[model samples]
Target: MTISLNKTIAYTKNWKPTFWIALVLGVLLSLLLITLEPFDNSNSFSNKYFILSGYTLCILIPVLLVHPIENYFYTLQTNRWYIINEILYVVSTLFIIFLFSFLYHFYVVSGLSSFTFASIWDFIKDYGVPFIPIVVPLWVYLRSKYGVIEVPLYDKENHKKRTSVTITGNNKSETLTIFESDFVFARAQQNYVDIYFNTESGMQQKTFRSTLSNIMKQLPTAWQVHRSYLVNLDYLTAVEGNARKRFMKISKTEETIPISQIYYRALGKRLSNSPQELQN
Candidate 1:
């Protein structure tokens, strides 16, 4: 269990998803409060709506503030993010929301004048205890739905030394040879792999009656970015997109290759250390 919790997972850093998740949570919480009529003192519908707005803001403000701050730290040490990190993020954000909600309740809903430690403790029992059961599971579900696992970085130096590579098909006679530096990317077709490489004349493609995995073993520098594509890091020029959707651009090719989420972190880390110019 400890080892499982310590395993690394993709940390969501994009603001768009953060905003949407907070918005949805706020809306849902507001609706639940409205239906339940949790606060009997706010009997008047207008007052209830105003109080609900405060509750919604409490949820939204903490989440939006916490996510970016956490993301900044995550960026500094990208590889260290794990399941435990995510759990702590969610719990810390919830604690902040609880503090905000407690203050709002003390000043506005309850119309209390004194702000004491005891009152805060009392409010936690009244409010925070009930919220945990519902919110934690919901958070876990959302995280699993959106999260991705990161792959470990490959040795970038291994690919740099090799100048030429020979890819062989099922038959010995079927083979294509090219300079390793000139190799761009490879895509798997039905039963053949299309190899793209640079030539003095122009960019060229050679089809081999072989699988992508078979081709990958021959090229030490090639990385399988997706199920159907293997890219040569030597030719990778740019990487773009948010946590959910990412694309890579090769130096000599106009085509953009889709990067699978599992490979995204490893690719970014590899490119940042590479001599090639990588535009994110």
Candidate 2:
């Protein structure tokens, strides 16, 4: 049952910003880091290095760790829960940074005293505290441009013309000649998309060297009814329910597509909104 909540999630998919916003944020953060208070006996050059290092470790680590986890949750279509996980991951990363710094000073960094609760608390307040919160959203924004949170879509709006796409696999190149109407569905098969389509003669299958999300955008306005499946909205002629999956009956074909539970709502909504009414 492709239903309400799923449609909401699909519409919000691919909420990535333009490149200019990322470029501006990067410049601002760099400038902010350059102007922070200096430590005693540290030259401007060395201070810059310390700030960069702190920013990288304290800020970047959390982002790097959390991004994959975020994607996993997004694939599961658990949007709200993923947001919660991101917040907890960021907070936890900040604590880890503080703990590691204290340990380093005590056991490694010379000219520093043994770790203490008061010192650790002060260090967190001084450095780890201010930098962590500022970095997560900026990183998320930048990374989203790379297709991180995007969902797959295909439908009639893109069905007219033949699209020539190059597919490379095993260091070899192959050309995929397709019209948006010819495609029935596609799936992310490991590093590639396993595509199902139709020709003037009969059904056909091909492997393409691209992700499902990337391929989805090129498709006509079909909704992604499963994390792995992108079906042509026009082809969805009938839907039959099953305990685990809903079998989708497509136009002019008896082959039914499987609709995963996660995408049911989004797919249903797209079907309800006649594809002819959707603006290209």
Candidate 3:
């Protein structure tokens, strides 16, 4: 019990810790129940054993129900089936545990010719209480840490067509035709985004809507290194880190975009861990 509780508390810092903990506890408790000699020579149900049995049910049943139901609520649509799902998880877990307990109890009775429900239940009550709350903190911590909430894009029109936007500067209104493929990088400045792309002549610049958050979705899977900037993961050539700052160098571009310190670790991890890049 002590070991299970301690591991649960510590492991809750990461995702799915309770699930791992519960599996271990279930096996350990079952083994202990099976091996320990029952003291029910009198063949009478005792309060001590009753409590233990209740606890055994508590440990496995709630965890099974909680994990699946929690995942259902978190990912899938919350329908009337949610309550039913919870019930099913609990019942299924209990049914399985009970089957094992029944088989082991029968083996014990057959082996020793002495066994009672009280003794079996006692072992259960003692082991199950500590495991229930372990699920909560584990779920909460994991959800908070890794679940990035994404805002759904409101796609009103199915615009299969691609066109160009003209950039009007102080002197001339240069009409630039940009194929979505040729465009490399873009940054928002107030209501305008200075777009950088390779042209026939050389590199060309243009200004367009600053609300590229929607447009960005149309682009490839790129990491938003900073609030103001998003860079193509493939284009990222080298990551430079100093005492206080970090920057990423994009291919075919000399300008090094600054990456926020908060995202440095994540960016570095992604760069080092993920494949070279899967170009869509």
Best by lDDT: 1
Q: Rank the candidates by TM-score, best first.
A: 1, 2, 3
User: Which runs in model 3 stand beyond 4 Å of their true positions?
Assistant: 1-141, 146-181, 273-280
Model 3 agreement with the true structure over 2-83: per-residue lDDT tens digits:
1211010111222355555555555545444444524354244344344334334434555665565455543442111122
TM-score (all chains, Cα) for each model = 0.54, 0.42, 0.40
Query: Per-residue lDDT tens digits of candidate 2, residues 1-280?
Result: 5322222232122324323433444445445655664234335343445544443343334334445655565556433233344445446654765676555434433246565689888766875567656755664555433423233334453556576443344434645666656677777777678777778788788887866555655554435666677776656665679767687777645666787765565456545565443322
Error of 1 at 278 (Å): 17
Model 2 poorest ten-residue lDDT run: 3-12
lDDT values of the candidates?
A: 0.74, 0.54, 0.48
**lDDT head-to-head 2 vs 3, winner:** 2
Tens-place lDDT digits, model 1, residues 6-102 = 4445666677767777777777777777777776675854567767766888888999889777877676553346566788888888889889889
Clashing pairs in 3: 49-122, 51-125, 52-121, 52-122, 52-124, 52-125, 53-121, 53-125, 55-125, 56-124
Candidate scoring better on TM-score of 2 and 3: 2
Clashes per model (N, Cα, C within 3 A): 0, 12, 10
Worst 10 residues of 3 by lDDT: 2-11
Better of 1 and 2 by lDDT: 1
